[model samples]
Target: MDFLSTYKGGLLVISHDLPLLDESITSVLAVEHGTLEPFRGNYSYFLAERERRREQRIRERKHQDEKIARLEEGIRRFKGKTEKMAKRARSWETRVEKLKAQRTEISRRGRQVAVRFPQPPPSGRTPIKAQGLAKAFGQNVVFVDVDVDIDRGERMIIMGLNGAGKTTLLRILAGVEHADIGEVELGHQVSLGYYAQEHEQIRAGDSVLDHMRTVSALPDRELRSILGHFLLADKVDQDAGTLSGGEKTKLALAQVAVGAHNVLLLDEPTNNLDPQAKEALLDALEQYEGTLILVSHDTDFVEELAPDRAILMPDGATAYFDESMLDLVALA
Candidate 1:
């Protein structure tokens, strides 16, 4: 961040990192309703100015609506009088239609994204346990002699510096990647839902609706409603490959929501999410009854999750979570 902020070069950055934008960029091109709303300053300025503009538009819209209502009332009174009055009423009706057409279009992007995870069936006391785990690529050892015992309803976070094998260990526990030497055991009636950092579950050729159908056998109407909750209602027929990074992340989480799994393994799940979407996700996860295993660098999200324990990686040491652990999260 420091380097980018001080660099003397022309750069065009597309990112969801607010701090990075505030520090490194002097301008913002906000995409709202398929239109670019350009701002001359940084992210903070954009937010403040955007809200001011929205308020102004709301006031203007209210005034226009009131004028239309008055004109409509006049038309109602003039309709059944003399022929001249009736003609004037018709003219007023024409003006009202024009006014309606000219009314401002306040963007619907501010609508809150609703992400809710239905309560999943209960699992045994110990949802997952791993023993003697180790992994390596050729001569590069990621981690070794790792062990983890995750309770059914506990929220656990994996913390480490970059390349400290946090993501690798999570993949191993989720059973998507194999540990060179280890045994992973699942407790009774445990169903796992893994949200990968790269959105690997969503296929490129499939449409948004198609991806949902793959995760669940629910009716098309129900599946579409679920997508709508994540603010993907209008994009149901659109190809998933064409979606932005944030949209793909939402779709991936949407799949997890429909899986009805009692255990969730989320790898950097907060990546690519804007502030509002992140807040919605946090709320849903907080209400979920399932066990959670997470890998994230966002300290605010970690604090909100309030995990029961943390597994520091590479050496694979385990400890009860505390405020001291947050410092390590930033280094990640």
Candidate 2:
């Protein structure tokens, strides 16, 4: 909003929400690259404007191609760089860089939204099964007979207030900690990727890239492309120990995103993220075609990626039910 001009320069806003743009903007600039079409009204007008621009772009692209051909011929004849041409090219490149930086900032913002994309999961495929599973810490019994089955693409959310043993359940599932009493079954094809709240599992002395390459045993070329998806490309050279809590969390998620993990066990995945980053995390989970077993307090996120089953542990006994965030809150 700050970027919008106080005077008269037209603002070019890129958003999927038309109503949002309609309310804030007076005019629209519909651009399809080779040509630009101006609209007198807001987003509604912009839709028609865009169609007009597309047609214009089709026509203009022919001329644009011819112009590029001529310029390339001139460039070829010139052979080497002249002082004036070099200075002009440098100025244009600087402007291009600045525009790219701005576009990156805007693209990051575009990923955030109140309404989420409904990413479909695969058909029924069980990843984990627990029969008469039980755990007790000291004298306080967490659960006695906990029986559950987690399937592929099934979103299972484990929820409880502070000190409600959600972490213990996740640890048991990940095989990081032993379940005190019964038989727990993990499917043969399941590959586990865990993001613990403490983040103590990842080695601290290595660079972010080194950690990924060493831990996942992925090649250097693949590591760069994978880390790029989580906004970790630039931070690849930085040491893991030097990263902030959010960076560490992001890096942890990046590893899971790139690796072969059919079963994802996440504890407070959004803890260190800002609102925008939280949206990104939700987007990732929503798009992920895997079995998700997560512990979260984010109601919006929980609702967006609704759990197939919810395990609520409050006071003492375990309550297995299908409940939305509002219903759970009302029960509370």
Extract clashing residue pairs from model 2.
none
**TM-score, cand. 1:** 0.88
Q: What is the lDDT of residue 160 in candidate 1?
A: 90
lDDT of 1 by residue, 85-114 (tens): 999999999999999999998876567889
Candidate 1: regions farther than 4 A off: 68-101
Clash number for each model: 0, 0
Candidate 1 clashes between residue pairs 3 or more apart in a chain or in different chains = none
Could you tell me every candidate's TM-score relative to the true structure? 0.88, 0.60
lDDT of 1: 0.91
